[model samples]
Target: MPARRRQQGPRRLEEFAFINLIKRRFGRVPRRVAMGIGDDAAVVRGPSTRDWVVTTDLLAEDVHFSLDTTSFDDLGYKAAAANLSDIAAMGGSPTYLLIALAIPTTLSQSDLSRLYQGLHRACRPHHVALIGGDTSSSRAGLFLTITLIGEIARGRAVLRSGARPGDLLYVSGTLGESQAGLMLLGKALTRGIRRGLAPADRARLIGRHRRPTPRVALGEALASRRLATAMIDLSDGLSGDLAHLCEESRVGALLDRSALPLSPALRRFAALAGSSAESLALQGGEDYELLFTLSPRHEAAVQRLGRQLRVPVTNIGRMMPARFGMKERDRHGSLKDLAVTSYRHFT
Candidate 1:
């Protein structure tokens, strides 16, 4: 019989090279992890005075994003930011991260390098450590998954089930800009048109879509102060996420349409695109803003916290009994059923 050929191959070499690239890029190991990338398994310190907050998110090509309108770095940064926003919603401090990627041959190593660099840029502020992960080639488009580990003082982590009736609902930062950006990009980038908007406006809207800021500090502040009754991050649009929070708490919400935060760029874009900013703010997804509920009494304290954090906080509505169902007050002083157009996975 002929001897079996050796398993050594160029594929193995390419994977090793990628590993080395990651090692060189993220070589600095945080004290929390005794071992990080370049190991069979990572060793992380156990929580002592705090509880761990864990979250995982999967981003698939063409579904979660379209490579035609997105860059590799934007993809990585958004993936990390999404996970961070999850931790933020729970009022936890991000510490460690693990990434699993199913890359396609179309993406080059330099593309991946930029992707990792974007991830690092987003996580460095939180001092999150890249512990370990798995990598494999995919026959289809790229797939990226991130598992983030965070810590919160024991029993201090906020949940989406603590909201009570009459509690005020709040959100940090403006909304709808992301959806506006996506619409503009899809229409303009795909067709090579950038007319009717200033360069700054275009950049602002696009930036909101490509990279979102996680309200970690505000979340921590709200949690540590015991202010927020229940909280959630607006990844799936305000109406949708609020619905999720209301469902979990067995309560309902009444939103003030006029109170919905709309960025200047979004307002301008809406005018140019002949669309309503209010609709985008209500139905737009991937804002990554924190939507939280707190008692009416704590409204003042929350305002102070927002100022201290320098984050724009708006009281958009209040919670109601489940029997009331979800509703919103229109601009003409009328109430209507809240329409949730949030992004759904299966649909």
Candidate 2:
């Protein structure tokens, strides 16, 4: 009888492995590109009708994720999602990506294949191409760097500084869901009991953490209709992103705690864990939803956009004079400083 084969096969150089995989995926050079992967630099044509948008993000092992908790596919997906979220926040459509992937000795050829597959899955729907990238061996765990390039019609890219004193603060979809998902995963990890959560609940929370959707469609719609006054993505939590937007616009904001949207899943998780959904919504990061401001006069228009796009648009607050500071209105209609800070590395 033949001996059982090891899960990981014989290894090869990083370049040899990745290049072969990329060539298999590409099959053909795209019409818009004068060059493909394996070049010193990628040369591709830009859309003449739109301005270029570029964003870079990094996902590191230990800092961003642990393989024990999530798969290589999920790491790839979240890394792409995070970069795509940046393009979406600008009211643009992602079109291209350049990756710098560092693989640790722990990863095998199959692992790399699965990781890139997840990245491709994230980009395929958005018509994004993987143009060029560099691969290197890593002494540490996995490190993924993705640079996404996108486009918005000339003069249509939303800036974080466009918000005004009277603009309404809005967020797409519910907050706290992703953070709750992270906490649940952490809980399961800590207790060493994966079955603590109901099967459905486990899937929901972990999926939210693993695969986040970029709001490109809604962002494009908002920009095309001239609806958003200012925009940002919820990478740094509501409190932190709100502070960033206000800082950019030189304005202040008043968030209504009652108006903040929370998902039923998050509510349930919070109840079970004795955690505060409000706190999660405010300070939890990695939501990847768009947060935008719009003029008060366009209230109806914003609602129409939301319905047309079939994405929830919650009006959580309004912009105010910068001197007024960032404040939140409690359910009792009392105002207090939104003193919470979002998560920061090494803080």
Q: Which stretches of candidate 1 lie over 4 Å from their true place?
A: 1-9, 188-194, 344-347
**Clashing pairs in model 1?**
none
Best by lDDT: 1
- Model 1, residue 232: what's the lDDT? 98
lDDT per residue as tens, model 2, 77-131: 8888989999999999888888887668888788888888888878878878778
lDDT of 2: 0.82
Encode model 1's per-residue lDDT on 1-347: one tens digit a residue. 00111213545566677667766776678786877766567889887889999999898988898888888888888889999999999999999888888778888888888989888878889988888777777889899889999999999999999999999999999998888778777754333335877889999988998899999999989998999999999988999999999999999999999999998888888888777889989998999999999999999999999999999999999999999999999989899999988764211
lDDT of 1: 0.87
| TM agreement with the true structure for every prediction | 0.94, 0.91
Q: Against the true structure, what is every candidate's RMSD?
A: 4.3, 5.6
Question: Global lDDT of each model?
Answer: 0.87, 0.82
